[model samples]
Every structure is written in C-alpha cells, then in structure tokens.
Target: MSPTVDHYRIVPELTVPGYASDALKAIVGATHAAVQANVDNLGAGTPSRAPRFVKLLRDKQIVDDKNQSIATTNHNETVSALRDIEASMDVNDEGVDSSTYGTYSVAGDAYVDIEKAVNQLQGTINDAENAPGPSVDAAGRQYWPEAVEGPLRTACATTAATVEQRMWDATTDIQRHAEHINNSAPDNPTSSGYGGTTAPLTTPWSGHSYVPPADAGTIDKIKGFAANELGVAETGTNHVNRPYNIDDAWCASFATWVWKQSGINVDWSNKNYVPSVWSDAAGKGWADSDMSSARPGDLVVFGGQHHIGVVVARNGNSITTIEGNSGDAVRQHTYNLAGGNFTGVIHPPAKTPVNA
Candidate 1:
C-alpha cells in the first residue's frame, strides 16, 4: 500500500523468468574485457621517462665496454704476431744461402729492407701500448679509442702479420747465410795478397839488415809495432833492452825500439835521451816543421824534446800517439796541438832497400 517500500518484492517480479541469470552473465563479461585490455598495455613504457643523465651514463658504459674488448683483442693479436715473427727466424747456414733468396749475401740490400719493415711494425705496437688514456669533453662526455684506431688498428688490419712473419723469416735466413759466407770465405783473399806470391814479409827482424819490409813503414805498421809494447814496463824481472832500465825514463828508448821493430836503422848515442832522437831525425832530412802536415808513423816531440812518441792517428787539431814511459808503461795518448809545446814531426824513411 505504501508504493512498494519492500525492494524484495520488486526483484521477485524480475525473477519470474530468466531475468536474474541474464544479469549475472552480463556482469562477468564486462570484468573479463577490462582484464584483457590491461594485459595488452604491459612493457610499452618509454625510456624518456627516466632522467636524461642516467640514460647518457648507461649508453657511455655500454660503449666503454665494447671499446675495452676491442683494445684487448688488438693487443693480444699484436703480441701473437710478434711471436710468430720470432719463431720463423732460423740461424742455420742453409737459411742464408744466396740461392735461397736470389742474393749472394743475407746482410745485403734485402736484409736491410726486411729490418726496416720489422722495426716499423714494432714501433706501431709500441706507440699504441704507450698511447694516452681517454679524455673528457666540456659536457662531461668521455672519448677514447683514438690512439688505438690510429696505430694498432692500422697495423693489424691488413696482411701485416703475414708481412711481419716473412720479414723475420728473411732476417733469420740472411743471418744464416752471412755465417755460411763468413765460414766459407778464405782467411786471406786474393785481393789482399796475404797468401799470394807478392805477399809482404812476415819474418821478424833478424838485425842482419836495417831495411824494413815494403809495408813495414806504413802508419798501420808503426801503430801495430807500438801497440805490441803496450804493457811492457821497466821491471827488474824483465827489461826491454840494456842501458834502458825499467826505473829510468825510457821514452826515447821506446821510440827507438819501435823504429827498430819497423826495420828503421836509427843511430843514436844515447837512446834514453829524447833530444838525441830529434837531432838524428833532423840530420837525416826526415823532420817536418809544420805540425799540420804530420802523418801517421811520424815522431812527435813534446815538452822541449823531453818526451817522444809515434803518431798513430790525427784529426783536425788533435792527434793520437803511442808513447812509452807514459804512466810508466806503454799507452796511447790524445793531445791537442794548440796547447802543448809540440815540436816538429819527423817522418821515418820509406822502406829502405835491403842490402843485396
């Protein structure tokens, strides 16, 4: 009577047929559709939602990792290449045969070329390994891989490893070839005339004649004779010659000894006196007043004709001499011509004719 205040009575009117069942089915269908829509939107979010700096850092890290891997691989490859080169070298005689490389000698032009190439390759590796580290730009961005790209990448890119291996192989082959040539070479070649009919005298001075061998008067011969007496000293156990005691100053005697060894007939009353040698040289017309014209095998008088020695070598304004009584033993000395009281240089006579 009060306008259907009981709601149960209204629902019962709808339930008279399949009305309740239809309402439940409609509600279940709506729920299923909403769930499926949410599932479709999963994993579709943008990275831009994150901070800009974080994104930049992440990208930089990824690039750095990749570059590091590249650098490591390059380094290992370079080392392996070098090792391969070393292993290919052979130090045997067959390796250096001229027929092998179409060259007579392994130390010739071909070897030089190989050496240069190998050195260049090694330099590339050294440069890359020692290159500077990464750099930071104005905006806090980092940069690397420049040096690696410059030398390392270029060296390892092409047939460089093959070239390096070949170079090393050639180097070893040449070394072996050089050894073969040296071993097979004659002790004295025909050009040197050492073992030929025209060979110079090899006999020691017999004192029967004052004439030296044809080659004995040369600068090299004089230096050789003086060099032989390098350690000789005035010792009581062994003296060089009579009237020339080891205790006494033997500079003049040493000069005379060298001259005698060279087969030069020197007549001196007092062999211990330097002035005597000078006077004898002057009388023989062997004295050269100009110091600049001094040659090897020439006599040099120093300290007012007090000390004397044989000139071994000369350069502009400087001279090397082999002297006795220097530090009480025969030794070489270098002097400046401008500072010392260097007297005239005396040239020894050329090879004297042997008395027939």
Candidate 2:
C-alpha cells in the first residue's frame, strides 16, 4: 500500500492520478528529443511538436507555476504542484512551468546551431584543401579538381593557401558569441585564444589558370549526363500522389550533380544538397548581374542561393538556361526574371586564375 496523491486540481489527461508525475518526464523527453533529433539527422529547417502538446501539459499542472496558462490556474493545486518543476527548468536555457516547457529565445537557439554549422564547414574546408589532385598534365600545369588550400602554405595549392590564410586572419574583428562562429578556428595555438580568425582571402584559381576537362563532347551530352545520372526529384507524383506542384523543389540535388561534373570543387558532406534551407550557401543561387554580362556555360545561381542553372544562350531579356529539376529533364527555360529564385551566378573557370 502507498500514500494516495491528493489532487488539489483535476487532471483529465491522466486517469491514474498517482502516475502523472512519472509521465511528466516522458513528455518533456519527447519534446526535447524532437528538437535534438532534427539537429542530429535533418541538419536544417525542421519543425517539432505543435502547440497542442504544450496546452495539454499546461492543463495537467505538469509544468511550472509561472508558465501555466491562465486557464490552468483555475485549479489552485495544479498551480502549486508545477512550481518545483519550473524551478528545475531554470537551470537550463529553457524555463519550464509545472505543466509546460518554454522554448529558448530565437537568438539563444541560433547561437548553438551556428556553432555546429561552423564545425561542419571547417571539416569541409580542411578536406577540400587536402584532397588529392587528378594529375599533372603535359603542360606541367597542376590539375587537381578537388584540392583545397591549407591553413599553412604548401606547394600544390596557391589560391587555396591564400583563402585559408585570409579566413584565418579575419576572425580578430568578430564580436559576440554567434558572430564568432562565422570564422572557423585555426590550427595555430595562438588563434585558439579569444579574438582570433583565419579568413578566406583568395578563391581557388584566383590567379592561376584552372582548366576544366575541355573535351566533354557537347552541351546535349552534359544534359544527358545530368538527367540520367542525377535524380531530378521528378515533376508528377508516383502511382498514388499529388499533382505536379510548386510544393516540389528539386533545385539543390540538380546543382550538386552539376558541380561534380564541372569539377569547380567543394566538399559535400552528405553528397546531396539540402533543399529545406535557403542558407548554408550550398544550393544553386547566384548574385544579381545583367543577362548580357553572363557568358555561355556560366552557372547562374538563384533563390537566395538555392537553385542554379547553366547558361546556353542569351538575348537581352530572353535567355536560355539549362536546368535539371525544372519542367522536365535538364531543359532550357527563358525569362527576364530568371525564374524568380534568382540570387547570383558563378562562372566556371576555362583557364586557371594565375594563367588567365
């Protein structure tokens, strides 16, 4: 026999009143787990539990007294029981009441996420800098599609060398906990201390002549390669699905496949580009530039850095751009607005920056 829990207030959700305390932990765990799990698996732009869970918890006196809704306050005992639980939550960034848990402030949550993103970016830059080149051609020009510059200077990579060193030095001026995340740390022990940076100075092939594989045959072949090799996220639904809709966005995966083919190298961790986020600078976006200025074969970025397309022909407002995840296969679209998802364009190198 055990002492019965006397209810000062009613809990409609939990029939067994004595066991409600144990269930409280599980609900909190479920809510928190949803957030952490999204960060661990999805990486960006994921939603968690909706408002109903919070309301139910509030009504049951499972949250803290301060956080309980005015409705929950109708019962005096419910309000009193939640007081301790809310106190416990005070230690964490998020505060909880007897019946409900509060989320972190927008700025507070963003800080930690930015930190993880920087970690990922650093590892990527390191790998790209160290990745081996394809081979040196007869002209003696160094040819490594994926090579990145290291923090320290080395022989094979000059442009990457400059970029790494610049990114390294740029961190000195950054302020606040979140702004510091933009600058990935340096290997130099001095840089690890507060107020340090090594920023990107020069891009790959900035001054060198980087030659892309010239004899890829034809533009149509590239289209075939893009369509056949890459998954275009298809327009229509499967056997049983919704109609072809704007809700479908296949821009990132298309860009990833094209970048691989062109060899304008960068490190891709998951191999597939994440579509849910417009940030991360990973998708097919470009900067604002005139149609006439963009050359043939230049990769046009769009959508604040989301979708990308390859230029084929241009005539003032009308331009033909090859895209993988639009209309049908890798086909051409014409428009002055650049399909509305416009951001910027990145021109692939015909010759190394040093040589050109």
Quality of model 1 by C-alpha lDDT:
0.44
lDDT of 2 by residue, 220-337 (tens): 3334344332223333531112121233344444555555555444343322333222233323333335534665445565543334566555666555565544433334455464
For each of the candidates, give the backbone clash count.
2, 47
Model 2 alpha-carbon miss at residue 60, Å: 45
Highest TM-score model number: 1
lDDT, candidates in the order shown: 0.44, 0.34
lDDT of 1 at 37: 17
Show model 2 residue runs off by greater than 4 Å: 1-249, 268-292, 304-306, 337-341, 349-356
lDDT of 1 by residue, 147-240 (tens): 4443333332221233334434544664464455434533212211111111122333232323435655355557777766555544543254
Clashes of 1: 2
- List TM-scores for all candidates, in order: 0.36, 0.30
Best by lDDT: 1
